[model samples]
Target: MKDLVIVFPGQGSQFAGMGKQWFDGNRVVRDRFGQASDLVGYSLADLCFTAPPAEVTRTRFAQVSLLVLSYAMYEVMTEDRKIPVSAMTGHSLGEITALLAAGALTFEDAVRLVKARGEAMESCVAESGTGMVAAVRMPVADVEKCVEEFNSGGHDVQVANYNAEAQTVLSGTLDDLKGLTAHLEDRGAKVVKLNVAGAFHSSFMADAVPAYTEALHEVEFTEPTVPVYSNVTGEAHESPQSIRESLAVQLTSPVRWSAIVASLVERKAAVWVEVGPKQVLKKMLTGAVGSGEVHSFDEEPERVRAVLDQLVELKKREPGLVGLCLGAAAATRNRNFDTAAYDQGVVLPYRKLQELSKLDQETLSDEQKQTALDLLLTIMRTKQVPEAEQRDRVESILRRTGDAGLRTIAGALAT
Candidate 1:
């Protein structure tokens, strides 16, 4: 298919009786769940498939159950659909699931890792009275605006997950969450307290990063068979070294879902499938970027069928469109194409030809506009745009169109 993208869920999507669907149909899924239970030194199936509300919802318990169930579900979904994949990506904890899909982690190894990871994250949370909640009905900028002032209110706070434009999550101290909830509601946003137990992806978990790094190194990593976009850097990684570093660093870094979504748009991924229990990413893409063509595995069968119907027609219309893979981006950059087409827009005004000219500060001309893009990029290259300033810097320059300094700055990033 021409347009294929996959997104996986994080910690919040877990529930009791996770593997019931699989266990009721397949013996292999049942056996695997049993093996995971023994490996974790407890019956995960019992707690997940039979336990009461409290224990099943525990952070440690929820993480393992979701991993096993999600992985098994992924396997079943891929059974007969030998659809050629274009690209793959995952969300916070879903990155592990993507790794399994990409052939980097075995199903057994990933389960073991998540089991240990859950224990570590949960044990750390036991010492601190902290939790997480989802804040809705606000843009990314406004959400950050609230959190910036929230730090001054005497609590540790940070953006945990930028799920979409309107649905952002803020993680911080328990009291800080309470304060933000009241303050945000007053601003007309609808904030919902999530059922999570601790401040994941915030500074409260900073103490866990080192042990995570150690755990990451203990396991050997191999380059993925298929490319996967990472959550921490919003870049595609195909090398073993880069994959390991990104996974280890994700403990302290915010989950960059907005960047990941934007990157997919830039790459022209025409279809996305969020392979999980719920349909959050589909709604998120619709709200944030105005595109989805994404469907969940267990999404209402009618909905999934409708999306597949679109994909069928789309593939017939563009059979040769294998997508603008990042490798192709490197190729075009080497051939001087994206910049060339852009350069021609200024130099030749929508023609495909080369113009060899030098730009001077004393003159404002076509070459000047082209070289201006390079100079602005050179300045950005030397100074790292701080986390808080990146969005503003890009936006301010973009809004001030036609001004050479601002146009150059925005063009530098657009390419």
Candidate 2:
């Protein structure tokens, strides 16, 4: 669970009725959609469930709808279980959803920021004739060279998305893209014009940056509870200030998606959950990371239930402080062979921890949890376990359970 990385999708993955199942099955999800509708000044539920494909696909409508749906899926998935997320990230518009998942932004604020962002991008498109195209089965280097050739010839085209090693997205003027499309096909790469509104992640969207940045400034960005990768930097955002700056410039910045995947792989992320409306990110992971347990929560009901059930089983199997204390008591060799001290320290606290572990974890108050942790540490200390090792074990438990209340106690112990 410490290796779990949850991802969200962005635009182009949306479709009519994308989140219908969750909307119908969960009242909280329904409420979230309602809240989003109010914030965006439109019936998002209607747009997602009953609107025509053309209407739902518009950038202004698609961005917020996908955000709400993705965030709702995330909420439903984690409501009853704790997912020890190692990190979270998203494609272009999905980065906003990632922030929401990581607790950096409230749903209301995310909705407003995304709404303004979508509107700003759409406005930029209206002012200029620009679009995007996907170049597949081509090396990123070759694709960049093609883009460079076009740019050197006075075209504004740029490689806007390094989606994968073999898939890249280019954005520029329609005429220039048309010419580039023919050139790419001639080079043996399949080029499909993307159904997008503007030359996103290119200088063509520069005007939108100021507007999006203005909206960004109005919202408060707190430190993420878990790491959230940035599309602009292809790395984990370091701080709230960094997030603010990265997001402001994201409009005209290429989505370094391949770089993000490489970073996750470097971190040895072993389990990936795409908690969004489509399997786009899941497919991307298969080609990028190459090996991992990948699940698309939105693809099927059974898949979603399977992941939730697995988390529940994992939580039950986590022995918490009891396992730590008992293992240390049994494993650490007796130094002084002080039997009475061992009985008073190790045996007594180990029994107490066993009893505490039997209680419903949710029913345990913060004081009780802290007391149990303290008992485990004392037993480890009595058994002559290294202080650093004890801290490591405690931190491992914290990572697996992601218990914020326990984190407070762990932080105090660290000091």
Write down the TM-score of every candidate. Answer: 0.72, 0.80
CA lDDT scores, all candidates in order: 0.65, 0.83
Please count the clashing residue pairs in each candidate, in the order shown.
Answer: 0, 0
Residue 251 Cα positional deviation in candidate 2, in Å, after optimal superposition? 0.6
Q: Pick out the ten consecutive residues of candidate 1 with the lowest summed lDDT.
A: 319-328
lDDT of 1 by residue, 3-91 (tens): 56767787777666665766788766677678788877888778877898688778778777777767776666665444435567778
Per-residue alpha-carbon lDDT of candidate 2 for residues 266-376, written as tens digits (9 for 90 to 100): 877777889888799988888567677788988864776676577667766766544544565566555546899889888898788888878877677767767777887
Pairs clashing within candidate 1: none
Best by lDDT: 2
